[model samples]
Target: MADDHGTSIERARQGRMTSEQIRRRMFDAALATTGTRGMTLGFPGLQMDDVIAAAGVSKSSVYRLWKSRDAFIGELLNEAAATFADQLSDDRALRTAIEIVASRPDLHATADGRRRLILELIRVVLEQNYYSTIDSAAWQSFLATSAALLADDGSESLRRVAETLRRGSDRFVEAMASFHEAMGRLLGFKLRDDFAGGFTLYAVLGSAIVEGLAVRHLSNPAVTDNFYLGPPTLTDEPTEWAPSAIGFLAIYDAFLVVDPDFDPRTIDAYLKELATATGADSVPPADA
Candidate 1:
C-alpha cells in the first residue's frame, strides 16, 4: 500500500500555479517532505535539488525567488515560523505557520499524516536552527508571508509575534530541556541531552509540541493545581462517580475550527470552577 504521505504529494501537482503559486507550492512540498522523511535527513539536509525535484519546479524558476539553497531553506523555515504563529492571537509568525500547515496537500491525506508533518515542522524550527539563521530580507518575507496567513489581521499581531520571537536565545535552551523531559515522559525514550542549545532548542520544542498543537495542544496540557493538565486520578467509585468533560469543552470553544456552537466564556467559567473546587495543586489521585 502507498504510504499516505506519498499519495498526498503525488496529488499536489493538480494545481497549475504561477510563479507566486509555485512559491506556495514549494511550501507545500516542504511540508510533504517532512511528513514522509522525518527530521534527521528532513530538516537541515533538505537541499535545493531536493526541493526542485519534489516541487517539480525548474532550477531557473526556483532561482527567480531564491538566490541560493541557503536562502531558499531560510525562507522555508521562516514560512514555518509564520505558520506556527496562527494559534497565538497577536502573533504573525505563528499564524503564518498555521496557514502553511492548513495549506498542506497532506492535510487531506490522513490524520496521522498531518500530525507527522506538524511534528516535523516543529522539530525543524527548534532543532535545526531554522528560523534564527535567516537574513533580514528573508525575515521580512517570513513576516509578510505570515501576514498573508492572517489576511488583514491587524499589525499589532505581527508586533506581538516579533516580541515573542525576540525572546533571548538562551530561553530556547531551557525550553529544549522541558521539551525533552516531556517527550521522554510521553514516548518512553530520553533525549540525548537535557536540551542544551538555547534558541535552537526553543524553536524545536516550540515548533513540535507547542506550535504544532497551536491552541488545541493545550486542551490536555492546560491543567494547573485545580485546572487539570492530564488524566485525572480518582480512587473511589462507590457509586461510579463521573467527572466533567472539561477538556473536551475547551476543545470545542477555543478551537472554533472544531465546534460551531462553542462558547469561549462559558468554558473559561467551567475551568475556573473546576480549578477552585479541586484545588489546583492537590487534587486527589486515582483511588483517593
Candidate 2:
C-alpha cells in the first residue's frame, strides 16, 4: 500500500508540471548544448538524449515536445527571438544583452565559437540550402517577428521594422569584421593568432565597447577629449534614453575624432568600467 502511494505521488507531481515550464527546460537544454560554436555546424551535433538529460525530461517528453531535431532547433531559435523581442522596448534589456556577451573573461579564446554560432544561425536562416529538413519560412518568419518587437505596432509595421533590424544587425556585423581586420593590423598581429583569444571575443567586445562608449560620449560631450558630443553631456543624457542607429553611428564617427590615436580598445576598457557600474560585469575580453 505504501509503495503504491509513493508511485501515485510521483505521478501526481509529474502531472502538476506545466507544459510551458517543461518546454522552457527543453529549449534551454538545446541552447546550451548547441551553444555558440555548435550553432554554426551544418548539422550541429545535437542528440535527443543529451537535450533530454539537460532538460531533466524523459525521452518520451522530448519526443512529445519536438518530434524531430530540426523541428526542435527551429522552434528553439524562433522562441528565443520571440523572447528577445519582448525586451526590445526596455532600453536596459538591449544594453544588458550586449554587456552579457562582453563580460566573459575568456573573450580571446572563444571568439570564433561565438561567431560560428551566429554565422551558422544566420547561414541556415539566410540560405535555405543549408538545412534540408527545416522549413525555410521558419527562419524568415522569426526574423520578421523579432524585428517587429522594437516597434509599438505588430507586423502591420513589420516591413519597416524588418528593414531596420536587418540593416542594423548587418551594419553591426560588418563593423565587427572590420574591427577584427583592424585589430589584425593594429596589434601588428592577428587577434586570433597573436592575442590570447579568438574571433567572437573580438567581434562582440570590439563592436559593443565602441558603441557603448559612443553612447556615453554622445550624452556627455565633456567626458571626451577627441569626440564631439551631440547635444547633451553624458551626465545630462538620460540613462533611460534610447539612441537611434544614426545616433550611435554619429558617436562611432566621433570617437575617431576624439582619439587621434583611436583604437577601439580604449573604448572597450571604458565600456567595461561602465558595465561594472551598471551591475553587468561578466564581459570577456575580445582577446581574453
Best by TM-score: 2
What TM-score should be assigned to candidate 1? 0.30
Q: Can you write out model 2's per-residue Cα lDDT over 202-266, one digit (the tens) per residue?
A: 44443454334434543673542232223331123422212222233332233222212334354
How accurate locally is residue 226 in candidate 1, as Cα lDDT from 0 to 100? 26
Off by over 4 Å in 1: 1-17, 36-42, 85-233, 237-288
lDDT (tens digit, per residue) of candidate 1 on 161-227: 4544444223444444444333222212222333345334433434443333322322543421122
Model 2 residue 97 distance off true place after TM-score fit, in angstroms: 19
Off by over 4 Å in 2: 1-11, 36-38, 41-43, 79-288
- Note the Cα lDDT for every prediction shown: 0.40, 0.43
Ten residues in sequence with the least summed lDDT for candidate 2 = 125-134
What's the lDDT for candidate 2?
Answer: 0.43
